[model samples]
Target: MAGQAEIPADVVALCDYERHAAERMPAPLRAYVDGAGADGLTAQANLAAWQAIRLQGRVLADLRGADTGLRLLGLDLPHPLILAPVAFHGLAHAEAEHATALGAAATGSLMVVSTQSGLPLEDIAARAQGPLWFQLYMQPERGDTLSLVRRAEAAGCRALVVSVDAPVNGLRNMEQRAGFRLPEGIRAVNLDGMRPPQIRSEPGRAATFLGLMDAAPRWEDIAWLKSQTRLPLLLKGIMSAHDAERAVAVGVDGVIVSNHGGRALDTLPATAEALPVVARQVAGRIPVLCDGGIRRGTDALKALALGASAVLVGRPQIHALAVGGAAGVAHMLTILRAELEVAMALTGRRDLAGIDETVLWGS
Candidate 1:
């Protein structure tokens, strides 16, 4: 598995893991992994927007020992890139979330296990050697949400990432057209036995799901959630500066500027486009992380230059897991770390902290 290079060298491999995953996965799984919400404009835009940003490279500086190390929410990470939470790893491979946990730990990157994951939180934690954060979905029942949070804390998860974007699933037209559904055997083990609420397809399941979302976590609920865990609280799916400011005001430990990988809202700004404004709003009071459309080390560098403490990758790692399980994931991280180092050297930045707004052009 280590020596295999399913993807060609000339291919600007964002992560070798994804290439392997694409080769191994069937059409249905591939479509599911690749599908975005609605027309997928947001998803497509996520990548496009990053390409739109141009970097100003510096020359003649001592770039011999560049570092990608970063400290986010008090945890030291080898790089400023993290694996974003993706659901139902069982859909990608047999090892499911366990393989991903092992791979993330192998490369010293953090993993945010999804509530919709196939494996239980405890099982993934048992295999993980690095930091783990639990991604929570505010289910219809508060008890279910609370139960999951408690379970994650018990399993040694260091933080709780409340996914605020998916109040309900987005209108993923591709999945709907493909008749996508989680296979029977691969259920969200965390929510097993207790059926939360059936998504009403007749009236559009997306709407039903959105309706159930606590719709903007009230300040009190945010306060209550914070009280529930000693771990730092991070609110995901934030896009606007207003929300970022509110998040900090309410005492959030961090804010992830994401559009749920453009899987929720179709018309929102790409995460990259929204990052600088939100980062400025947060003003270093708390960590500001960006997710959605990050496919290269340069993208990570650009985000860091714009004030993001770290960047989260959503689909690429899942693609790696689909192709080669744990080994694929490790390969993908290895490639990304190397690419990030190269980007740092080329940009004349010695470390992640050195990448500031000065490196960006055209705002």
Candidate 2:
């Protein structure tokens, strides 16, 4: 873990960490962390969509008793910014998720540990000072999935975020061009003997649609998942209003409006474009969280005005971790929280509840 003194003097904002990380990381690992689906169209759109939204600022508003605190999934979080789950933290820093857990705790931000994390889930849980949630990828067998869930439950994970978007890996061309591969001793520790062997395609048959997707999760699988865990269940990668409505109908605790950071599929609409529609479809039946292209505090406020309950910061966490380990992550989150407060004060809002569509230019 890095100390405060180790953080660079120029690292004053979240965006700055990206440049520093690119310089610090190996070329192959950097490409893997930054790559998205084919053509990189959707990933580029995510940032542009958020930047295009205009904020409406106000003057002479009361600022007393204002705070960023909010209650999410029965946890009273100090702020709405969450550390979005990213895999293979060891590729960026030596301490891996253990360092990230400490950084999140220091800033009072919730940390979602990925199913593909480099370290053991129990070890990460022990290092976290605040609440932790587990992001799960459904295994080929029901029993294998249940075992992961059981481990998460025993580790005291407060919620379960099931990623339902990608049935198979996307065509990440940038990663392929860079020849990215995980070095030895940095595999998904929890999935040592559990992940199913690759499915070989028959001659003259489709591989993805016919072979591997046979294990893809269906609606019935989600319903079965809900029955197996007492933790709050949130479905990630819900991009359509129809899917959001169906998630509510299936008795999910929440729905995350995301396009998997534009990593899972190419040419999909950005999360900023999908968030308002999904939030309206759910109609407050459950919390609607979103992740993708959130780099600034203003971006988070825009998401809330458009109807997101909270926003998740994804790639920036890794960038910060690479630059300064735990201290870098904490500083980056702290800077974002301060910016959120400034935006709220300038817009005449006292707290998170006071922020609504009115804060946006054309609400």
For each candidate, the alpha-carbon lDDT, in order, equals 0.82, 0.91
TM-score, each model? 0.92, 0.97
- Candidate 1, residue 81: the lDDT equals 74
Reference-based lDDT, residue 132, model 2: 95
Q: Per-residue CA lDDT of candidate 1, range 297-340, in tens?
A: 88888889888998898898888777667776777778778877
Q: What is the Cα-based TM-score of model 2?
A: 0.97
User: Per-residue lDDT for 1-363 in model 2, tens only?
Assistant: 435328889988888999999998888888899899998888999999999999998998878898889999899999899999899998888888988888899998899999999999999998789899999999988999999999999999999999999888888999999999999999998887886836786788757966588888999999999999999999999999889988999999999998888888999999999999998899889999999999999999999988888999999999999988888889999999998888888888898899899999866
Best by lDDT: 2
Off by over 4 Å in 2: 1-5, 195-198, 203-206
Alpha-carbon runs more than 4 Å astray in model 1:
1-12, 15-20, 195-217
Question: How much RMSD separates candidate 2 from the native structure?
Answer: 1.4
